[model samples]
Target: MTICRLEVSNPAFTPDNTQFVTVHSSHLNRRHDVSIYNVNAQTENVPIIVLMHGVYGNHWVWMGLGGIHHVYERLRSEHKISEFVLVMPSDGGLRDGSAYLPTKGHGNYEQWIMDDVITAVQKTVENVTINSPLYLSGLSMGGYGALRLGAKYAEQVSGISAHSSITDLLELTEFVDHSLDAYDCRNLHESNIVYWMNKNKNKLPPIRFDCGREDILYSGNIRFVEELKSNGIPHIYETFEGEHSWEYWHTHIVQTFEFFSDIQTHRR
Candidate 1:
């Protein structure tokens, strides 16, 4: 069990309950950046929440310009949450994000996260175990990653939260340029959150997602929710007053953490 290589120095402290570490992933053959925020480092057996970033964004997007750590600190301080570790990983070496997929020639980005990233975290963080509860959440492209992978790997996670997710990878045409052959396109479609959720309905974990009314992907999110409803699958879907910007994601991420917290409580 070789976790990814630690390519960076020891954890650097900041005022916002955050730490930065870089790990080299053999899967991707590159160094992957990760940002961790431990609300209570001494706490044990708490869920590890992986907060993935959207396209053109690295691990820093959530805590940096988005001020997510600040919001999370506020929520935790206000007694809205129990302590949890936040793992933010960069979608490395992709021109327009990997969509966290294992595409041809590029590399197995999925393995990079599921194995290399998780192993690196366990090795870097004290007392982290294979049996520790896990959760996933992300925004935009990250939302796609969280929802799709969360469902695809449902056995490994308790729940998932997606914000402004690209429920359908075809929707990505609006944002990125691609010259995919039929197989690549089909493979990507297969990984669509809605598609995979249906395929894994029996194993689906608690799922919640929200999108802003002003977002271009709002219709897609609504359609996805409808599909879930039609199939008798359970999930939480919300529409708020903002757009696809970080402002919307930053403000609402607290709701996501709260959702995961509630799931942890009831499952106990």
Candidate 2:
């Protein structure tokens, strides 16, 4: 049995309702951090949105750099969205990025997000429970994680959204200096986004992805969307007018929140 332990800390820089948690994951045999924004602690049955970060980013990037907390507040205040607990988790501290795939030597970064992170949130947050609806969203490499993992574990996730995503394992070469061999796993399908989506197409939750027109990854995202259409996989894809930067993610993250809100409304 793998025993995972957690320690909670309040980072001084975090906004009023955010809590930073460090988990000693047996899967990775190292400590990873997760930043949670839980304004709906007193509210029951609030959905949990797990946001993953891309290359060169940590757990706080979503809130500290992207100001997602501010966006959530505005959406909730205006009743444009349902109450949600935001969870931002680090990508297992690999090189420039982990690709969120399980590697032979580096341990299972995939489980670190899918299992340990969710378990920690349930244990720490008062209102988040096993019953809370689970949503996944991310950007760039993180977007790959959200799309792949959400499809692989369709039964556990309610919806998925991504922006400026790396659609294949080879795409990591564009951003990272390391060799792609570091991310190789026995099951090749684990590293391919379209494979998992097609394998679990019947069970996949509502998925949405977008790419900026000028971003380096725009062509790859276009190819991915075309493949999805050819395979009859269900998803939402959009093209925006920005490049791959925090400016783009921060401006368009509202669409992700609103997309999840729409899912929640329809579920009820």
Candidate 3:
């Protein structure tokens, strides 16, 4: 795992505004590059939030839309959370259509995130204390990753927030008419939500999910909620009138932050 402290150059913003130190690693378990957003706050022990980006989205995806600056500034300034840090790494270049899945040639992405990437982040933050709790959230493809990780390790995270998550992979596959032969046996039982949920039935984490009503992925989102209800899984689900655009994603991300923040406070 490679982690560094370097500033990104974005001419659009002022020197200071663009001066963000990024920590990224590329060679952990052959997983996707692990990139994190260090707010440069003045605290040794900060709460850490592992956020992921949607398909084809980079770490900068949430920078402009999700009031990202506000999210960072608010948490840091208000001391609204525990030792706080935001870790956002893309699912490789799989931002657009990869679905955060591991095809035949691809390596084990789920294990990479669950193990290497997470270990790298924890190790990089040298001052992390036992009190530090990890929080996670994501949008679209990222949304799927965030919850999957949390559900996979319910004992580790405080909570999870998902924006426009394609929760029901079985339905999503049919809706998109995509092929999953590379990952599964050409059946939903292998990698879709229908299977993912069953695998995590006894240990699913607290969930918050939302989507735009006009978005084509609305069906998949609603179906996820239905499955949760049928299985008596506790979660928060809602819908807003909009399309599959940055506008909707940006609006919901802030809400996601609020939800995560509240979880920390209540749990503590």
In model 3, which regions exceed 4 Å deviation? 1-32, 39-45, 64-67, 75-83, 129-131, 170-178, 184-190, 194-202
Tens digits of per-residue lDDT for model 1 on 175-235?
Answer: 7786433113445455666677778889888999999999989999988888889988899
TM-score of predicted structure 1: 0.92
Query: Local error of candidate 1 at 222, Å?
Result: 1.5
Tens digit of per-residue lDDT, candidate 3, span 95-168? 14455555565544555455555665666555454556777788777787777667766777778888888675
Candidate of highest TM-score? 2
On lDDT, the leading prediction is 2
168-250: candidate 2 lDDT, tens digit per residue: 88899999998888875678577888898888888999999999999999999999999999999988998999999999999
**Residue pairs with clashing backbones, model 1:** none
lDDT of 1: 0.80
Rank the candidate models, highest TM-score first: 2, 1, 3
